[model samples]
Target: MNPPNDPRTAADDDAALRALYGRAQAQISAGTTARLHRARHAATTGSTASPARRSWAWPAAAGFAALFALAIGMQSLAPPAPPTATPAPVLAEADGAAALDDGVADALATYEESPDFYLWLAANESTLLAME
Candidate 1:
């Protein structure tokens, strides 16, 4: 290995690398060289896309823009949708014993069905109070 601080060694190394690169470059096939040249030219000229492909870009962009505009226009021109109708809340009757709402009637029916639970609680009331 060349010394890191030696300028002569660095120069010699650079020259050797350049010579190696040149020989390898010279060994490349003509077809490969032509392809490399074309690639370099295309990169430098900034024309990687074919003319046919590039031709469709503007039209495609315009078509998308037109579609977006049509969608927005249709949304604006169309009538506003009618507000959704919700069921009116059940109100209590003026008289105390009149017809009850379905929810209240169902709760009353459930309590009536579970009379055994109420009876058990009544029997255990004194014992539960004593334990507490």
Candidate 2:
């Protein structure tokens, strides 16, 4: 006698359930494939963004060279001015003042010996005194 609830009948009606399960599995696999593709793309882009080991030295050297050149250019463009030195003292002859005094004495003697010197001096003496 056939069983009251045979598994075969349930399985015969299970086509719809099987189709649903297959669709869910397919969606999960598609999502996983898309995620894997995105992960691979991200890895590739990350590697490209990083500097290569072989070419690493060039960037560092270029940076140092640029800094060195800038330092040299600034130093050459605005060099420090030279320090100023104190000026030397001027020297005068020891007899210079004595010579000037003798010349003045001779002029006074000559002016006194002139005949009209007193009359001229008297006329201008008040003006000369006023100046004094």
Candidate 3:
């Protein structure tokens, strides 16, 4: 192996690489070599499709563009859909207020009947707050 500061020139390195490449190429089978040559030739020649074969693409593209424009035009010309008439919500404001009042009254009656339960809840709430 050469040292970090080897004195080899670029030309020497390129020559060595070429020699290695030549040896590798010699090892490739003839069939593989022929396939590689055919691939390279086809790439260089570009697409082999005849003009007649290629001509259909333009008409197909134009047809697709016309369909897109027609769709847009029809959408713009059509009348806007009428707004849907949704039935009003079943619960009215007054009904909701009455229900809330009833719930509050029931809760007050329960508290009045079970003051001890409320006290226990309050005591437990203080202990829970301290834990937090």
Candidate 4:
């Protein structure tokens, strides 16, 4: 015959459930124990690393640094343009000769003011001509 419906079975079931709950709580308190093995296994297989990681990272980094330096130097080192060509000399020799002749004409006007001055000047003109 089926055993009598005992209330003790219900108490046993309650005890079992409490034991399972305590174990789960303890595992949780121990801080994520179940995922650690899987994480380590993934690292061992290189699954945790990026698949498309470049192998020439160092050279590429150096090249980029060199390019950055080159760009900065180019920005700072712009050369100044040369001065433009100037126009040719405007005053000729005949203009200078005309200026000297105009000065001599003014001196001859002063020379005509006295007759004794003219006689003395005429005597000294030979000495001046010899010096010249």
Candidate 5:
């Protein structure tokens, strides 16, 4: 007969299952029990990692990391294309260099001396700056 549902809480249900499992286990043969015992032992004692796996994992990971670092460092070795155009070294602070600097002073002097020139410079200021 089937068990009653009422008055049987989880502990009662667990006792019933244990009794059923005991009866089922009592009926099994000796050879089947030994095979089951061996299978259980082998499974519980199994090593998930083998020696061959340990041999290569760290070395392979390290080699790939080194190669990646090498690729990153090689980026700076090309010397940046020599800047394509070198700016001529200015011979600043010399007598001749002072004359080259006086062009702006000379223009400013002309503007200050002539009122018409000052108006012309004010009008052309944007164009003059853009050309420079």
Candidate 6:
């Protein structure tokens, strides 16, 4: 049943909102009402026409799926490349006559150049320890 006062319940509220549209027809200006009608008509017509344009989305998706399937099929049908051969690891060696020739040369050079220092260190090591 319709309430005599302002709407309180949900049904009354919904009915009150619906009645506002009829009231708006008398209150709103003629130019504003005509613009609203044109806008509503345009929106409904645009939505009905959109499905014809949106139908391309499905076919585009199907084409992409077909391309992906074709790529996978082609890859499986083709032969794989051959494995590469690796070279064997080499062993490093020196001739017996020249084995570590630089180590012996360095030791002999230092001893020959500073024989006096080596001799002094050997003779005076005990005195050095006493000083420490």
List, residue by residue over 1-132, the lDDT tens digit for candidate 5. Answer: 545666657668899999999999999999999988877877798943345768888999999999999988998675676556867666764767788779879987877799887678788998889899
TM per candidate comes to 0.47, 0.25, 0.36, 0.24, 0.32, 0.39
TM-score winner, 1 or 4: 1
C-alpha local distance difference test of each model? 0.86, 0.82, 0.89, 0.81, 0.81, 0.81
Ranking by TM-score: 1, 6, 3, 5, 2, 4
Model 4 reaches what TM-score against the true structure? Answer: 0.24
Model 3 lDDT per residue over 72-130, tens place: 99999999999999977676877998999999999989888997988999999999999
Per residue, candidate 6 scores C-alpha lDDT tens digits across 50-115 of: 458888999999999999999999999999999999876444444543667877998889887997
Each candidate structure's count of clashing pairs: 0, 0, 0, 0, 0, 0
Residue pairs that clash (backbone atoms under 3 angstroms), model 3:
none
Best-matching candidate per lDDT: 3
Per-residue lDDT of 25-67 in model 2, one digit per residue for the tens?
7777767988878779979877543456669798899999999
The 10 consecutive residues of candidate 2 with the worst lDDT sum are: 86-95
Model 3 TM? 0.36
lDDT of 4 at 129: 98
Scored by TM-score, the top model is 1
Q: In model 5, what lDDT does residue 84 have? A: 67
Least well predicted 10-residue stretch by lDDT in candidate 1: 91-100
Instruction: Report the CA-based lDDT of candidate 2 relative to the real structure.
Output: 0.82
Q: Where does candidate 2 clash, by residue pair?
A: none
